[model samples]
Target: MHQQDNGKAETFDVAVIGAGVVGCAIARTYALAGARVVMLEKAADILDGASKGNSAILHTGFDAPPGSVEAACVTAGYREYLEIREKLGLPVMRTGALVIAWTEEQEAILPDLIAQAHANGVTDVEMLSREDTLRREPGLAPSLRASFRVPGEFIIDPWSAPLAYLGQAMAHGAELRRSCKVLGGDFGGTHWDLKLSDGSVRAGLVINAAGLYGDDVDLALIGRRDFTVRPRKGQFVVFDKSAAALAGHILLPVPTKITKGIVVCPTAYGNLLVGPTAEDQTEKDVADLVPDTLAALRARGEEILPGLKDHDVTAIYAGLRPATEEKDYRIRHHADQNYVTVGGIRSTGLTSALGTASYVFGLTEQTGFHYDPPESVHWPTVRNISEAQQRDWERPGNGGVVCQCELVTRREIESALEGPLAARSLAGLKRRTRVTMGRCQGFHCTARLAEMTEGHFAVPMAEATGHD
Candidate 1:
């Protein structure tokens, strides 16, 4: 599996495992800070992990208690998201959010929730009177009595956020080795001895952000094993874009100590996202089993958004949260091992990724390790919104529509095939161009798109389905 690149050995100041939101953000942070970073992902593409498939809510972290690490990190990452999104020209729908209560008992929690929001430094949060709530969102359930309206809360296209981060990292001198699984590693005195699927990669620092399989990655050689993670599966049903306006603001059920309840939120892609059944499962391919939860999710979603019954479901998907037994983030540095373990990132991982990276970098600093910036770090420049992103395909050969289900054109597919972040599977194209993620679920478009990728990338038809 080993392949030589430009007849030279691959080396870096730090090797980041897993290209999920947290891992990519961490690698981007280091790359921007002038570190020679190399990212190793087990998958064919980056951000295809839980990062691409998430709730898509930009939380104010108001529901989190004050002084908790989760609170601090989410709050910080929320602010950082605005800056990064704007800088990258990514679309962030700053439409705000609300937590609605249906009963009197649920109403009682509103005041305390406001207090908690304030405690978390979210000062813009306010308890909405019945009239005020109606004024803001008249379409809300008429039975709702109390709610917390928090501005600055928004919805984002979850796919582009992490991809942009990793894209920026790659532009800024970070090298990414896709589908290169790290078999094991040894804690070198300075550089860690890495055993990758391709071959070996040496790094003075190793950052582990392997999500669900994090423990397995470090089990071969490690130090602190204070916590264990149980995979909690969350199933979601995506409604067609036509029904996206079903809710004006995010409608969230108050969370219990065990789990955050189901939420109905509108995504930046102009689609409604509902469900995400909080069930605990150990299955690795959880997304494939989401059909089993569809009926339950439909019932639960109707209870939240009644008007959504008529909207056709575009797709149903599930992503497993690496929920750990630990109450807070399981981030720790082994100075001697020259490794940092970033595991147990749950559903809120996306909202806290940037902050998590910054904190991890601090841990690296406190360890007394230092690196000079690489001599040459070139960042690839791309438009904030590509031509294909305009909903029109006018780029010569790229303009022929391929994925009719999502209005994705051949130009867009080809761009993904040849661009910096290429697509090797059906799911990869879905995340990048949102093709086949629409109402038909690629029943018609899958074949054409598959043919295009097969011809363009020389990949076998079977492997193009995103199956290993």
Candidate 2:
């Protein structure tokens, strides 16, 4: 990995802006293809943006617009994730999703959605009768309606997946710069000089995978943009672990053109999740939780699974998606300038990231830039934080537990704080080790964590609380 020095401009073959999941995957792809790659993130840590909060479902693209880039990428990325997840120690909860139609009108749309699923190459989707739906999920409210089962859809560890992707990229000689913002750039025909917040770097090609700020990055570097980023905020509510048993499958509502609607699914971390009330907002960064919205979400969750009323609420959070006026993804390649813009990737980004990287790599190749992929690739396995597998606390020599609620160990926390992609803040550490994210929400572990993470975070623990 190349370190930035103030004395001179560092050089690389590729500079991928934004360290979101898509950017991480793009960096990995270029690095594996034998390009010297550098990934930049404006946040204190990777995934501190839109990538941080999500439903964590690995979609089958069953309901995605057929023949669209989103569908193709989701299909390819889904296949690739299943093919490589075991090697990376990524957890997959094979809880197939059920798209239930509560209303008669929604039931009328099931056949068309099933046809769309088949058109998208997911032929295993089968329509289920009301009896079959109730049998599959006994805890679901006895709503007199039918549903379709998308067997390929499953839940995955969202944070660990990208961390593993970037980790493998670093292992294969990719450099990551967190807290580094790309202020502007100059493309000089043969190469590009990117001006960052800290210093400057030169690269032969630049790929804009900046999720929410994608348009801004394109405008800054190329002085033009085809699409404007319209931020759409989605808030969610997480139930306690006990509620996870209520939903055997990912309970999904029939998707609308605007959003996928609310999803009541089980997280890989052994908690039931219901969320994502879609609200269009002008604010790009702050996705504040609304009391009334969350209350409505809780009520909707109870309506889906009547058993949820008995469970306590664990947490509530919100995420912003880089939505645009158009439904399709905004991807364009400028061969003359040696640039590619990947924008307008919304909710399905987690599942489509890898395939998007592959597509973007092909676009980069169109500019006459190519490299021989490494003969042998390094596959780095991330630490298991999901309930689908044995956690560090369950193993011997774990150095004792730190967060009792999540069973996070001292050793695990230390490891997360000591790596190349180390946790630089409380949020980063939580994403890495699941600390302070359980039922107690760090009530019992904050003091201990503060002692352990002192002087490590950019903002000290005493100064910052929930902001990180």
Report clashes for each candidate as comma-separated counts.
Answer: 2, 0
Model 1 agreement with the true structure over 280-350: per-residue lDDT tens digits? 76765455555557878977777777777777787777777888786577887887788899888887888
Best by lDDT: 2
What is the C-alpha lDDT profile of model 2 across 280-324, one tens digit per residue?
Answer: 988888898899999999999999999999999998889999998
Q: Which stretches of candidate 2 lie over 4 Å from their true place?
A: 1-7
User: TM-scores for all candidates?
Assistant: 0.91, 0.98
Q: How far is candidate 1 from the true structure (C-alpha RMSD, Å)?
A: 3.3
